[model samples]
Target: MENLPKKVRSKKLNTRVDLTAMVSVSFLLIIFFMVVGELSKPKIMDLSLPHNDDGRISCGPMREGENRSITVILDKNNRLIYYMGLLDSPIIAPKEIQYGKEGIRKELLSRKQNILGYSSRNLKPENIIVIIKPSKKSNFKNLVDILDEMAIAKIETYAIVPEFTPEEYKLLALK
Candidate 1:
């Protein structure tokens, strides 16, 4: 028995895991996450701010016809009140319009066409200016809707005026 050669055996490994599949799966998961992150971006609106002191001054007092201005007032309960020209003596009476495609959008399109027609006939074309006023009772959604309408109507000039005059309050109260 001592003369017999001793047999040597190889030790077996406890774990035999193939890391190739796991590495490929991890790479695929990373790629999927990266692609999803790039595809889910928020849409943002571009806004322009007014200059502090632009050295540009009016040559003369604004002509009554040249001032194609409209004021849009957003009140509570989804009510919209708009008037043409100055609030002191609006060319058109304070009219009430609802919020949506059929209401405010239609009104804006009609007004824009009217202004465009007048502008084309005049020697100098004047783009319409819209003044947006949101009351305390109005919510953020209303403000956002008005801004979206401005964009949809292709309105280039607009301003947000926070103050509401006594007359405007009375007008809103009437509705």
Candidate 2:
């Protein structure tokens, strides 16, 4: 055995792995995905539905429009018909108003001003009440647009009335 060349022994390699870089890389990947997920999340609006925990609705008694209420009817073909107060007696007759600054926005602003002046003059505790009624032909976008208008108008009291009365059906039929 001594005559034979001494077998060269291979250097023992370290068995321990430096997990710091690997752990750091894994944490970076996790944080990157989390940030991307949050950024890609879809934005949405909140809708209020009238109902109770027991599955019973409590919308309260309907008010016979006292000229302080406005009913906005959303129909197909992007048609918006609005009137102040009940159909039987309206402060402002139902008319087709546009969407932008020259349309619904103008109407809402003017009407709000009128209501404020009238209430102040009469010394009545009243504010503009908006009732949104979306017909069957109307789309979700129409409802959303109206809701956005309501917000832009800074309307404090508004309700989405899903049900349409007989008079409303007739009015829509005429559209």
Candidate 3:
């Protein structure tokens, strides 16, 4: 009595890894870096400071011919020492100009057409007033190229007075 034959067992298979295409490729690389970080931003330039009620920091009294008022200064190498009114008495004598587009954009478009032709013969409406004076051997791209020539000479009255008096530092130390 000898009859032994019964043996058959083979089954082992378990391998599952399907993270939905790697979680949709990491959420599409975090929405493509948040839309390229908001389209690479950077473009600013809008300064407007000057408000002292009782501090007494006035920039007044310089009116006359065409209600005169210029005074540009920005000296040192790229020199552009303009003049017309007030710097403690400067009704024209600082002239030195130089810096692009036919130098200071043709002297700020001929002083904004001579202060808009003397404010249109006194009816007034274009009181051109620009006093930038950036000394300390001027730099910072000559105060951003004179504030981009006061916005390409459309100047709606300007004033960035950062101190320079002492007769404009002895007229920029006699140039």
Candidate whose TM-score is highest: 1
Error of 2 at 93 (Å): 1.4
Clashing pairs in 3: none
Q: What is the C-alpha lDDT of each candidate?
A: 0.80, 0.79, 0.73
Q: Which stretches of candidate 3 lie over 4 Å from their true place?
A: 1-8, 33-71, 74-175
| Off by more than 4 A, model 1 | 1-61, 116-126
Query: What is the per-residue lDDT of model 1 for residues 140-161, given as tens digits with 9 covering 90 to 100?
Result: 9999999999888888888999
Q: How far is candidate 3 from the true structure (C-alpha RMSD, Å)?
A: 15.0
Model 3: per-residue lDDT, tens digit, 1-175?
2677666676777778879999999999999999888787776898633334566544654244425578788877778888876655665566787877898778777766766554423423346778887887778898998888788777877888988767878888887
RMSD of each: 8.8, 9.2, 15.0
TM-scores, all models, native as reference: 0.59, 0.58, 0.30
Off by over 4 Å in 2: 1-65, 120-126
Worst 10 residues of 1 by lDDT: 117-126
**What digit string (tens of lDDT, one per residue) describes model 2 on residues 36-155?**
999999999987444555777557653433557888998999999999876887767778877777888788888877775544223232367889999888999989988888888888
Any idea how many clashes model 2 has? 0
Shift of residue 172 alpha carbon in model 2, Å: 0.9
